[model samples]
Target: MLWLDVTHRPGQAPWVRLMGRYLLPPCKQRWHTCAAFLPQGGLLVCGDRRGSLLLFPCSSSPGWAVESAGIADGGTSPVSEDTGSGSEPSCLSHKGALPLEAPLSVLFGLHGKMGVTSVTCHEGYIYSTGRDGSFHQLRLQGQQLEVLRKHRPCKGLQWIEELRFTPDGDLLVLGFHADNFVVWSSRTGENLHCIPCGGGHRSWSYCSNASAEAFAFVKCGDVMLYHREAEPCEQRVLLESLHGREIACVRRLGAVEVPGHTTLNIFVTGSEDTTACVLALSERSRAAMPLTRLSDHISSVRALALASPVGVFGLLEAARKLVLVAESFHHQRCVLKVEAFLHTWAGGERHLLCSAATDGSIAFWDITSPITDATDALHRAEGEIQPLGGCSCQRLCSASRGRPRWWLLCSLPPSTTFFHVPDLAELDCWEVAEAGGELRYYCVLCGRGLEMLHGIAPPESPLLGAPQ
Candidate 1:
């Protein structure tokens, strides 16, 4: 139960053979399954075909296998001596492998008859959906599985397809397989409300704001936004038709509070037509307004991310006020450009900006160092995106999942890779997608087309907190 790198090609014998008792499917079980990793890195919860859930933990690191491999000859599996002729029997020599140190240990198992479809891990508990249309919450008490609560103790709803946990609260949104979606309170197990998401789940992609109070889901190129409210009218805040083209991606760029001034939510939508539209959501009126449309790349923009705020610009304005203290401060310079930052986001600890360009190169910027004077500010005003560090990641598109761990995903292999939030280093990565063919070594991943909204830092305003 460790993640080992089998350095062998596909359709080939595994390099390290663990020969002891391993956990396999119980005899003959179905295969339609779903899984989610627990917050703690080692454990993984998986739904099985026999309508059971299993918790599996990694017993060792593949790196450890790599180290022990030397003691085991690593991968020099002895093949039959060919005898240099076609009439020779080949003898197998077992010299390169040892059994896995620890067999797959089943920490918790919920055995049943129906198949489990979806599973998600929350603050402390585990939620799952089964083919029986039932939802269950399980907690690992010691070595046993404890069923804390089960929604629809009798009959369940239509097969639930999608599950989303609100970012800021204890709300779980479940999308049904055939009809509308429901919002449930994971805290109290109450079905808070229901939203009509077109037809069960077809082509709609959903996104929500930080609080999860506001949500937008697109269906067949048309976008609809819904927010939680006491009345019906306020529930449907936006409904826009895209006329024809499908939406490639959409994101909540960033949220900024102007300190006793205004708080705005930024959103960017990239479509298939090689264009992106930036929109703003105002908290005062709970309304979404279109801001600007960006069209520069001839190809479809694939990803988006948000970077740190341009707080350095404030220094230029601040320096302007010190003119009276200088005797010969006579002239000033001004520059403007018509370039467009169509796909943008600020993340990676609010200091790194990422964007996926059409030329197959992903760019990253260091936004942590704010400009102190008008000189640096003028340098950036020339419409050129001067990335702090630039590398070529041949990806079509990508998007930033936004703050905390400013995760950026692209279409290339190692599909999910991230920069260290604080240092922007390419150290940690997650390869979550199902493997299709021979997995090969990959280049560093880069790309994003979404806007990164303001981070969770307190707004330090020279304009608001200054001496009047």
Candidate 2:
């Protein structure tokens, strides 16, 4: 296998010519079947058809990141040297420039049964479905993966083509080759709903609407939209339709919210028809509304993901005066929907929203802009900002030129970088203050605080926007 290292500047797409490639060791079984980026860091995990899982550290791997205070000679370009070959993820900085083929470490030797078809990561756990009809969960402990548990094999469940975890983490949905989808509990192996209809169950995505009531997926070449009558239970599909061609991908985009007008759900889909289509969904009894079509790509558009617009957007939406507070994801062990939360201390109270996890993990976050009020406790708190062990949100990072983020004080063993934060249910508040360029945070729940950074300059921080 070959890897291309290209430098892309803003506003420019990168182009790498595929000159040639090298062959790997002869394997009679299937080659690399699937690859995934680990949530913990930059480790790349790939599973071959022969049941062998390999881990590629990549030139941009996070190994060099943790060990070094700064990127040592980390720059743009490819230089070379031959250290021969061994099994371990390789980074470009360690080898000077770049290597045509970097050795990959073995994540799993060989499954006695079969190979993996679908792989996904949530929090610190990795879930994979194998050809042998098994759903396996692995936990990342340091650089190694410890097998946590695997679902009991179903007698005739063949070819799990796709897997998705609901935002609540209560459901583990599996799409099969036989044009049907099944839901199961992520923690327990109890089988739940089995909905069989439409096509493209082989390629499907689960996206929740603003109310978190509906989800849409593609089966065969058709789209099916379902509404949850109960919280994560009892679903009724409001609409279903067949596209003219194979539905390649469907993703839910942020919908426009109206005060009195019926809010229309919006989603975009790409197809083998070489066209991207937009459709509208209504909460009331009706069919999916077709919006417009654009034939941009020459070939099938394979994937669709949501991202913040790079250029100006939300300008008109901003005029609507939406005060953005915080973002959210699922934290299962803690029973909280979020794993960790962060904000500039200058933000006022309710500027912070916190809930506890069962594992003693807590996240406090203020989603919107800072409102100055000296009487506010959160406004006085500064500097001692850090995230917990199992934080899957944006990580605390540093660079030679960019600013450095502070570390969260953790009670878990020093070796543990991530924690499940399974211990939260009540309000755990904190306050911040800065003295002589150093920031300190006081935990109202634990009656403790840690001093964060010492030389934090004015431009390096915004929490100090108003000087005490």
Candidate 3:
């Protein structure tokens, strides 16, 4: 698929073009976690079963190979060689070797044979909860790996399925079978709060935009929005009976588009019923609209992310256009994830439609050529436009400034891949064992560009008598 550069004014072609056919070696086991674009350029961290972790660089050079396999059982005693002298029975034993590899080195022998279920990073510290019911904090000091904090058998949380940080840096953990979530102070590891929601065998939870004053969580068929109040806490069901099926993923739309009215917060939910819906929330009531019906996969959806603004803007203007990407499923199946990017254009003349999809392969289509005026076109077209290309994994995310220099994160089955549009070739890929993990790209706190980047220049030196 061709990656078009949409940051520039429409009609300007992409500056870089790379084929989207390169495939990495398959892993011995499935990936359990994936992180993209570390502080270092073009580097990704992936963790998996067998207690292994791998780091892949952006380039194809030999220097890119790095591995951290799991640890082995030390040979502190001999067992099989023992022979019974008389009546005492002799026992036979087998020696277990340690799995030494790079990514595993980062975990520092904290994770056990049950393997890791969730991983997240905050500040410079990496926090992960293992299947062994342990929570660990791993920090990097120069080249040494240190365990800052380790909690064996987290008090109430078991089988951590997801991890998120509140706006205040409070860690929010979702327990798989326990039916509860815990919020902790990151600095002190003090448990601040624990909230319970009904649980399901395969349910997952995620927080909305971190900066929001409140957050929301969805599991099974329920979506609850929580607001922090001084007097008492309040939570209401914004939308329930979602998709008439099990909810797999929830994502908050970045910002809304309203000409003159106050914009409201919106969220999109994907479910196991082969349907996805968009929900708009306001002080008065919640309205949900069905967005798409994905029919190819029989399993529950594992990942969902928003596209870059280039795709967003095109869809906003036309309300209908076609673009597609490659996508894969948790069952190691590949299918196309397609949707229309639609928006009401100038003068409300037409509903502009731009489409995007992932079919395990990349395909590009430019629908900018206007076909008809807005009013007449809406009634005439029966459906939205469809974009090209397919994605293996559903973990989609886009980052951009004012312009359309957005990057798309595609979480494949065994690898986490990245592609920048409108030049839609694979920019980088990291071998990760799991899907539905989270990765973020942001400057370190107190690092360079933290202040200057967000700083606004002082108002021009005003003369003693500046113009009123």
Return the TM-score for each candidate structure: 0.31, 0.34, 0.30
Answer with 1 or 3, whichever has the higher TM-score.
1
Residue 119's lDDT in candidate 1: 83
- Residue 225 lDDT (model 2): 74
Q: Which regions of candidate 1 deviate over 4 angstroms?
A: 1-22, 30-32, 39-42, 63-112, 153-156, 180-205, 210-468
Tens digits of per-residue lDDT for model 1, 1-468? 223344454444335433222254553664537766677566666777777776665434332222122113344544333434344222222223334332233422343565676788777888887645556777766544567755531113455544666555555645553456565554444466566776454544455554456546777788877775444445552554321244565656565667885667666766555656677766467456666556444556556543322112222232222111111111121111112123445742443444443334444544344422334544565432222322222222232442223222222132333432232111112221224643222222212222222222122244433211
How does residue 410 of candidate 1 score in lDDT? 21
lDDT digits (tens) for residues 239-356 of candidate 3: 4344544555655554465777554445555655554456554423334444333422334554666443223222313432322322223222223343444455565543333333
Model 2's alpha-carbon lDDT is: 0.45
lDDT of 2 by residue, 1-468 (tens): 544444444433333323212233446774777777786665666677776556665435322211111222443334232334343224443443333443345545445346667677777777776665456677766666667765532334555544666666554546443555555543343455556654332455554443554546765567777666545546564533424456655555545667887656566766555556677756453346667554335466656544321111111121221222233443334232333234454554344456555545665654334322212423354543221111111112221222223332221111112212122111111223444645432211000111112222222224323321
Give lDDT: candidate 3, residue 384.
43
Candidate 2 has what TM-score? 0.34
Q: What is the lDDT of residue 241 in candidate 3?
A: 46
* Whole-model lDDT values for every prediction: 0.45, 0.45, 0.39
Error of 3 at 397 (Å): 64
Q: Between candidates 2 and 3, name the one with more favorable lDDT.
A: 2
